[model samples]
Target chain A: MAAVGTPLNRTLVRVRKPFSEDRTTAVVATTLSVLALTYPLIDRALNLGALDDLFPIVVYILLALGLNIVVGFAGLLDLGYAAFFAIGAYTVAILTSPSSPVASWLPFELNFWAALILAFFTAAIFGVILGAPTLRLRGDYLAIVTLGFGEIVPIVFRNAVGLTKGDQGLNAIAQPNIFGYELNSSTLWGWWYLLMLVGLLIIFMARRLRDSRLGRAWMAMREDEIAAASMGIDLVKTKLFAFALGASFSGLAGVLFASRYSFANPSQFEFSTSVLLLSMVILGGLGNIWGVIVGGLLLGVFDRILSARATGWIQGLGDATGIELLEKVNLRDSRVGFFGLTLVLMMLLRPEGLLPNAQRKRELEAQATPEGEVRVDETLYDKRGEPL
Target chain B: MQDLIQALLTGLALGSVFALIALGYTLVYGIIELINFAHGDLFMLTSFAALTVLEAFAIGRGSPLGTKVGALFLALLVAMLFGAVVNVLIERLAYRRLRNAPRLTPLISAIGMSFILIQIGQYWKGSRPLDVPRVINRLDLLGPLDIGVRFFLRDLILILVTIPILLGLLYVVNRTRIGKAMRATAQDRDASALMGIDINRTIAFAFLLGGALAGAAGVMYGQYTLTTDYQRGFETGLKAFTAAVLGGIGNLNGAVLGGLLIGIIQAMSERFLQNGSAWANAVIFAILITILVFRPSGLLGEQTPDKA
Candidate 1:
């Protein structure tokens, strides 16, 4: 949205060249979109049963992409990103679910689509409310504050039995309707097509934003706050916008998650889920949209399918070999451990992530002088926290 | 008045445990300025180790007092050593290399380390809460003195064990060469390195002491509460972290004071407020958020400019 030659737009032309000039990237993106659109139908025709987990994984990717806006793009480490996810789902459930206690007080059950829109705004508002105060603090303190908020949200939801029905949770939520047909978890094909379109649109929007003036501001702030401020970037506004935007994306995913499952529960928004999403983002590559998607898909498939199958195979082998220790082995119990290992190993060996952003990869790999000073290449970038 | 006094006393005993754990957090945070997220889980592992040791000795309610004491001492030693060793290992394996990297790198790694420790605890002890055998008799110690209040022997034991350790820690930090090195490192790592102080060893020593404190807290908590679980680490770790922050993170006396205050608040709420037990965590988290926002330096911390 920035006009040409404004302070933030100096490097826009330079940054847009590489991606736009690459024909292969465009072709690969198009191919992936087409495949994503058709996968559900193919799975159904073959009775592959991949649809069951694929839908949730899509939602997860959507979430990771949203998180990328904050942790990756904006450079804010949010340990409680799931709190926004919870808020989004709970908002929709409380509004549209017949089982929700709010039904007694409210005159009508809101339409699913209307509730979804409301949930997005609700999550965004909450994001600002949380970010406004905490973002003023330093990075790590903001992390702990967000973590505190994340831990508190579920507790409040769980304890507020009158509204959320306590541990039993809100079920039988209204499903999104297309014409006369209602879409639920069983209508996997419909949900898949809808989510695929949403995901694609979001991916497109994310790309556009990445090239926009605001995105540059976020990157500027993330790289160096004081310098970004000196360059006339509003640090508070940029950080808050990123935080709110990231939250809204998670909210969108939450609405889809609740609508598909037809249930909303506190347990679904645990700290573990947040960490799992973080792992996906890190494993795929931070700050890269496609990388996040790949990371999300890889880990999601592993968690939902491969891990279980591998465990069963191991157990079967143990039975055949009569090895008692192998028979007792349970991979599910070690799932979190695996994620933890991914995080530690990734940070240690490849902090730039698997599919690092071009700029990020360069920054991480930038050569250091013998005196231990990083020599920033002035040809590619300036000290204003911009690419060029 | 009677209930209030009882709550206060119980809170003091509970606070002592939190203080121990909180020391570990404050110590590590003080030296490295990195939140050792795995410290709480380290405490949990130590508790499990202690449990296993006690189980091996078959020390239970039926055991003789002298034998029980001896077994308890052995369990304590094992737990401390286990905690210290494991903590040092985590620092070496996960955190050591990332010392010069960005702040978030080691933090994320610490979180991973925490999850791994939780997994280990789960595999060792199963997921459910295990009932810890009550080795000390629950005899009322305050009744003999006609104090018109009930203070159990367990409470006395908790205080007796914790206070001395706290004093010993204070003495070491104030009087020992290594402790001075830790303070020097905390003040400025690069400068300390330039001065020829072994930064790695000082950092490792901080972890060792912190881990020992966590180990001591774990055994005391498991024994006092009569239960231990894998998930206990996250909850207790958060509370202890809160204590550390409340008392001015990186401040020893601050952590102890914060711990006792939090314990008292929890006890008062759980006893006085309706459904307070369920809401206690929420209250603590609220306090953490509020304090960090309003007084980021904490009650006892110096007002360092926000390190952007």
Candidate 2:
């Protein structure tokens, strides 16, 4: 087993704190720069009532960040992230809604901030619960098991009518309120955007964690668990922390999602959402924060733009072709086709991802091995693709 | 007593189907250590293919024996061909390219292929569940003990037919030249290649055999359930995969035993456990987790040098 800072230590480490003098200045400058650059588009979109278009992007960005911790930094494939999102949303729903038991327990009604805290903890506890027992399994087995958990959670939420209202979903979930002021109606977007800003702050904190000793431990475990353990990295605790923290963000995202939508439903948290989140991590380049943000925004906006315009595009093509069957093409269904195609193309063209971490990029580049040349050793190309 | 007997019978029948599907998962995982996420979708496609072939036979309106026999043979052939072609294409297009990539890369590709297959199926058959025409006769015999023991003769015959055939497959896998080559390839791909075995051909053969079994399972499942849905394979696939893992993923006989155990467990849980139907999935996962924790190599799994 290699020591933490040995020759094989290829883990990328950002030494500066995420919100340190340099990073803060960079963030502020970038924000100002971006705002200045997109001023015209922002103005036009806002003028046209397209501000809501940014909401899903914000939500997805947060989801992507949360998932990156588990799947990217920690190298744990989680297919049930939406379950945590569902949990957070349902937590908020159960606490703030007029129908909730939480309202009855309090002297006065608890607001969204309080509910948000509760939701985060509720989802986090569930995350820990789920992660505790299953974190010991091997990687692919972990993925399948998590996939099962993802499938099972929603079904439970949907069928447990006494608690979750089943498929009917919890409606009339209250929006967030800060002290005397209430964020309601169209104004709700302001609060949601603020919440997303806070989520970005959390992402910054997560970025810090990614560079910490804990982060190094996670990377080690991901590279080789046995080796990591041999080097005295506490496997159990480190894995639990990854699970817990990854799930905490998912829970937080759920709170924002619930409050933004003002509804909590099981249908919203499906297996496909998990796939989308995973794709975001992959597309953005795992272990790269900025890449994940870009990936999330691209996929989120792509989904919205494509779904809205796909029918029109299909209709135009159908008209040109004089084919009635083509006219019936539903862009909504075709979105999945687009996602599939994108993944395939991405794998073929840039397997390392759009903004891959330096180390991951190098690893992928190393595997290409100049196309036609065959490595002589038969054991060299095992499942891990490493020479034995 | 009657309920117990009925449950056992149903469990065995369902277990047979699970075992068949699981064989596909185990075989592929055995050979290449790939999970073949698209496998369930393959199973679903094969079911539709069976339906298409059976429909062409006009078996729904014919004599039971002739229709059953004809539909059985035609459906199996068509389904097997579909499975083989699809599996081969999947290997070539999605998996083969990722041979040198990380484990996660191929898994993601499998997922992408799954979506593609499902979309294609939806486009062809529409998203709605299609009813498979019943062409087999059901036989119910009164027990000598006067305890009612109702049985579907088709299920009994299906199991009786499938078990022997599956056992024959086991024999071939353990004894035949191709089978030995497959084992060698699975144990060490590069070594087998160096020894003049075509690694790609061995993988294709594995996929071919796995696909054929999935096709057979689809035929049996269609006959038993009388309906096939695009999404039907998802849950069944997960369960069968669980069985494969439970019995030791790359071990052939282990998959068979695991499938039967899972099938019986599922049936028993649904019949006896509280809120059984609702919790059945969770129970299966709980069992999987337990197995993983206690015996990661699975019941009959041997430790391979290459780690996935």
Best by DockQ: 1
Model 2 agreement with the true structure over A11-52: per-residue lDDT tens digits: 211222222323433474377447634544675677855456
Supply the TM-score for candidate 1: 0.94
Once fitted onto the true fold, the runs of candidate 1 whose alpha carbons sit more than 4 angstroms away are A1-31, A366-372, A376-388, B144-149
* Residue pairs in candidate 1 whose N, alpha carbon or C atoms collide under 3 angstroms: none
B136-237: candidate 2 lDDT, tens digit per residue: 765554444466766677778668867975987798689999999999998888889899998888888888888888888888889888998887877889
The per-prediction tally of clashing pairs is 0, 1
Q: Chain A TM-score per candidate?
A: 0.89, 0.82
CAPRI-wise, candidate 1 is: medium
lDDT of 1 at B231: 88
- In model 2, the Cα lDDT at residue B125 comes to 85
Q: Chain A TM-score, candidate 2?
A: 0.82
Clashing pairs in 2: A378-B190
